[model samples]
Target: MNCDQRAIRFNCLGSSMIGIIDLPERPLPRGVLVVAGQPDSRLGAQRQFAMLARALARRGFAVMRFDRRGVGDSEGCDYNDSDVRAAVQEFCQQVPGVREVVLLAPGSGSAIATASACARIDPRVRALLLLDPRRRANAARTAHMLAPPVPAPAPIGAALFWRRSQPPRRGPSSGARLAGLAEQLCAFPGQVLVVAATSAWAGPTPAQAEVRQLRALVERAGTSNRVQIIDDAAPAPADRAAGGRLDGDALRAATCASWMVSW
Candidate 1:
């Protein structure tokens, strides 16, 4: 499906904000409203947001990306909760088919602030997409000024673990325990083989990137021992037979058993 892109303007507290809406031939009820950031505006760093909007629109989703105060054609030097509400209102009004919206904040620079502002967003905003939450840098200074306070942190994602002869536990451990375990592994008088899982699904996930980071950290920490990865996906091929789960499970078991027996 083809997407049509057009510029738009909206008023928030008497200031004009510029934006672009990516409309698909047949749009879905759920749309993406990109929360503009500083120094990049709605285009994003290297036009990432624009490309993202177009790509999403091609897949039948309606995407709206607005500019922050300082960037693009937007006026004034500040934006607030009013701007967000106005944008959401404009987004819904522009795309009548879209009843709900998901706010996408691209970087950690303002990830927390953006999410914080929407703590009590309009009912039409169904979700928040904050990319790179691992490296949060700033908090909206005026966040407290908003009527309802920002909700407590409700992070989503899997916890990383390190397995040993008698590992800490079978399931996810607390952050403190995880840190202590990492320190313990670095101090242990033996080799460490970090086993991180990869997906049969396409594209690079945070888990995979974290696996690489773990390997690098271990290499630096355990300077004397030989550290290696046991489940690195070297560009996994398509699941031809669609039995990726069966094959992956069998391979993981065999690899672990063989490694233990060899040791």
Candidate 2:
């Protein structure tokens, strides 16, 4: 599998932002754009994504993975919802012969993918692959600050009741945004794949309940959506040492069914 990496500039948020492109040995029908999360630059740490990109390329798919805004070789400030969405839009438009786009995002990058899908009305985005969907830590912090603190529910029943009784919150609600994105994708007349990571941060076991809950939530939100959960064992010693590099297999699995995979 031959792979070539290059840097280019794409229009994002009305400015030229730098990005990296991973080209395959053979020409591909569709190009996959992988968007990285949080600490940005996945250039070196994204071995799994890199491997999958090469694998997909060998399978006749062109793949591209880039740093968000202020990360890596990109020129711009930090990224937000708008910035991410715009970047995806620009990449989709700039990449030649991109028949379809498969968004592969890990952790908070899922939120960025959702936002981009919601904002762009292109039918080329055939599928969205969310690996380890997580509520943005910043959003959670804001929610906590805005929400009235409950004085430790007196009992389990009370806690449940309190949770049920509260009116469903709305507005730039992260859950709502995610649901909106899912709805949009389902409405796209294409396929959607959601992969949930089953392991918790501190444990060596898969969180079956968590994966089930996430699947149910997506199913309930979009009846036509297709969701899958792959329960991986706790990261091996090598993966633990590599940090986010462990996500390659999950990403490749999610993208294999779509036109191209990106994470």
Candidate 3:
């Protein structure tokens, strides 16, 4: 039988955050809470988040997906320490028999999840599944470097040259941040799965570089076994050629589902 799912509204910092809870007929001892980053609601892009939640629920796991403070039907600005904490509390209270919680965070939400898990901020949080965890952009640093104290007078008829000034190049800071997060999570007493998706569209992608850097950091932390890389090489040739391209989202969902079931 299909699980019972209901829309929920949870109060956070005096505002409401919209969410949905999926409870299996016979629930597992663990529950999952999906935390998405900015610009993505609980549904996720192309409804991938909803699909993954339904899939997991069918596999006998209790699942909850919610919007952050301000996105979707939620109220208030998305700036507060109570985002993940409130959601976890609501999930635990609503789900009757879950003994532990697993946070499934994608994109920049991974950083939030890692910080919470490492700090043991919530005792119920037991594991993390981070997919394509985005590196935090150093906007202040970029702005500082790009905007010089004084601009030299543009040469006569050189307006185009001035317009083409590119922003300052980013250094290894993003990699360093990832390394720090991985180390913290490794020290925590819970399983952490760092998943990297290398391709997005049918062209050269930038996430590949990030994945390499993150993988190196995990290896340096002596936790390379904990990271899972889903790229061109992992899929079978037939799967890759099914539609003359690989479905990155499908691969990611399958990898996550398989790992969670085993965990």
Candidate 4:
């Protein structure tokens, strides 16, 4: 099926922002705004964003992928949540009869989306699909990693243990940042889908605290159903048959779209 893709230029704070809208021949009531992380264009690495837009359009949705100010063809010197809001508004205008809008952000874009959602900048944004939201270990967590594991009990005699001599160069503390991000995301009055790459999933790592906090906050807010997690580990054969491509990302995007379609 052929979808109409149009290159659009819109004004934002006296600067021009460029975006592409994929309009399905037979539109649905939903629209999706695909936000790129810092330093990534709308096309995304390996054209994952483009592929995602096409996939969503094939499923009868209005999808928009755009470059933030100062990136790609957009004219500006900075990028921020305001720029994302501008893009979302532009996307909504291009897709007629869209009753709901979903914000899909991969990587660091998750932070931006979370900020926007917490602020409730746009009421039309009904959900968030965060594919690999940025997560990193904090200084304390790093120290813990460098610390030696506790000795096993006498009954468990085969446990191996090792310790590093010294802690390496310390990175900035990320606990506060990650905690704030999670809080903001949970504050959103809509659904949130967090899709993490197994390679980076925090569930069983030093960064698990932040992920756990997010889940706890969501549950406390009484919107546990509003948050979902997808651990994308081994890529499906179909996704990998494309050769050296970022098939995992494409698969994640497709799965997200399908989930939204059923919503």
Candidate No. with top TM-score: 4
Q: Could you tell me the lDDT of residue 216 within candidate 2?
A: 61
Number of backbone collisions per candidate, in order?
0, 2, 0, 0
Off by over 4 Å in 4: 109-119, 134-178, 199-221, 238-246
Write the residue-wise lDDT of candidate 1 on 1-263 in tens digits: 88898789988777889999999999988787888666678987677677667767766778899986656888878766667778889999999999877676643434434544554446666554444322222124334566587686654444222223345534333343334434443543333344454552557776566545545666667542444444434333442226543334334323433432332
Q: Lowest summed lDDT over 10 consecutive residues: which window, candidate 3?
A: 132-141
Q: What is the lDDT of residue 221 in candidate 3?
A: 75
Q: Write one digit per residue (lDDT tens) for candidate 3, span 79-168.
A: 455778888888988887887888887645445545465337777887777765553333334676778688777665567566677666
**Full-model lDDT for every candidate:** 0.60, 0.57, 0.71, 0.71
**C-alpha lDDT of residue 81 in model 1:** 61
Query: Per-residue lDDT of 1-263 in model 4, one digit per residue for the tens?
Result: 57999999998899998999988888888888887876789998778789878878877888999998899899989887778778777877887778788887764534544536533767788887776554322324466678898986553333322223345676545566656656666666777787765554234664344566656666776667766655555555666644555466557656787678665
Residue 148, model 2, lDDT: 83
The CA-based lDDT of model 4 is what?
A: 0.71
Better of 1 and 4 by TM-score: 4
How many pairs in model 3 have backbone atoms within 3 A of each other, for residues 3 or more apart or on separate chains, i.e. clashes? Answer: 0
lDDT minimum window of 10 residues, candidate 4:
156-165
lDDT (Cα, 0-100) at 163 in candidate 4: 26
Give the Cα-based TM-score of candidate 3 against the true structure.
Answer: 0.71
